[model samples]
Target: MDAILNLRENAARQGEKTLTRPTREEAEAAVRTLLLWAGENPDREGLLDTPKRVAKSYGELFSGYNESPEEVLGTTFEEVSGYNDPVLVKDIPFFSHCEHHMVPIIGKAHIAYLPDDRVVGLSKIGRLVDVFGRRLQTQESITAQIADAMDTILHPRGVAVMIEAEHLCMSMRGVKKQGSTTITTTFRGTYRDDANAQARFMTMIRLG
Candidate 1:
């Protein structure tokens, strides 16, 4: 719960401040250290290049840290033909690493918002999901981040976000419960105040 709150409070802090990062050489050295810790020879013929590969892969996997949600959602179209209904983008495929285990949490996201005066491009919602998913996250954090971004950036009437994911920390380790799934959701504005609106969002996600 504290982690989620910290994430929400810090959501707007990204792209607003300078972030310090390690260089590629430093990252590669860290991977080699991990290999040694795992009882593997870093100098072995086959493993000699493994550190470089892992470092490169980590750059792609965690690139979300370099992206800005405000910039991704900056543009909006007021010419939505006077449309004020809910705009939903469902089943947006995404995979994230669990902050606890740094293992995969594969899932789909369903995002819906009640537009006020304007609407954003549909593709922006998918991009928004990726912006958060490519980071070390808890399912709950991603769910809240999506809803918070839409709510803050678009100033929509309401926002609803649902994420269904399988955490590898639970499936591949800990309890080792394979195939188990977890769902997390965040509702804001009208979706939080009105039961009917929230129910309709659920129905659309289920039927679609």
Candidate 2:
């Protein structure tokens, strides 16, 4: 509970931090040290700018940490036209970091909700995934966070989230299987109790 609260607070603190651009010189120095330790010459022209480029790329790849899922889901539309069935957005691609290894996890997320009275914009679901996915996460927590966010924001009859990912830590080392994937899911409210509804959701997402 305390951890959840801290996440909420941290989300609120997004955009307050001073944007510090990492120095190319520092990155080059670090790379030099790495290359030296690995018995290579860092001064080689081919690898000279690799460190700076990598540092810049890191800034872009990890920028999601400075954003918030709650704020992304803040916009709500009560004008759902009373046509509430299941609003599902599937195959939402997300790139996240694994907290355990600090390596990348790339995945597709499926989100579905049965609205109560209010509904959110379609894009908000994607944004929510981005918010949660950008942080250091385990697949289990990522699944639960999406469900919880939808339950909180939409007060939906049910909310379901499914994630399928391939972790680099698993693929790049330690019994490496190149084609392996992991699936994690979370279901809330009616989706949790009603097998038929869950089945429908799974079928829908599984469809190509």
Candidate 3:
């Protein structure tokens, strides 16, 4: 678990080398380029200020880059009074952008973990979901990331993350399959090894 923590921290530090901070003007210019590519007149009366607005919106939409889930889960209470059981947070609403099309993926995440000697704040679990959900991600990757975060940080006996979402890329275009939903799951430790524990998590979420 310590190695997992160090690996993620090192990865984040290494990832910084490939990134260059662009100025607001540069960001706005890129938006204008997209507008031109989309066949929209950037100088038109209706779209003149659109580039700046879109640039600002992107900052808000992808703010996850500035956050860390491990930090958010950093504070835990060991005074759980020997309550070493599964803690679950279900139907945590989140909105993410699909990396493939840069479109919306609306969903709910159901997260659970069996604590060892420490338990995190319940709201932190929901916030953990939001941190990852705010980034451009695939449903599969995000699900796995959440489970792994819990496993490494809380050192839980097990961790389970299930995400159910509808991607705008699929619903609004492509096959135009409306009402289509995608579900993904990741399990770690006991959740991965024990069938009954897994079944209990599933049943609890279904009842919710």
Q: Write the per-residue lDDT of candidate 1 for residues 53-79, one digit (tens) a residue.
A: 999898789778767799899999999
Cα error of candidate 3 at position 58, Å:
1.0
In model 2, state the lDDT of residue 2. Answer: 33
lDDT of 3 at 127: 84
Ranking by lDDT: 1, 3, 2
Q: Model 3 Cα displacement at 13 (Å)?
A: 8.4
lDDT of 3 by residue, 11-59 (tens): 6878843334678899899999999999989999999999889988987
TM-score of 2: 0.80
Stretches of candidate 2 above 4 Å error? Answer: 1-39
RMSD of 3: 4.4
lDDT against true structure, model 3: 0.87
TM-score of each: 0.90, 0.80, 0.90
Per-candidate Cα lDDT values, in order, are 0.90, 0.84, 0.87
Please state the error at residue 49 of candidate 1 in Å: 1.4
Root-mean-square deviation (CA) per prediction = 5.0, 5.3, 4.4
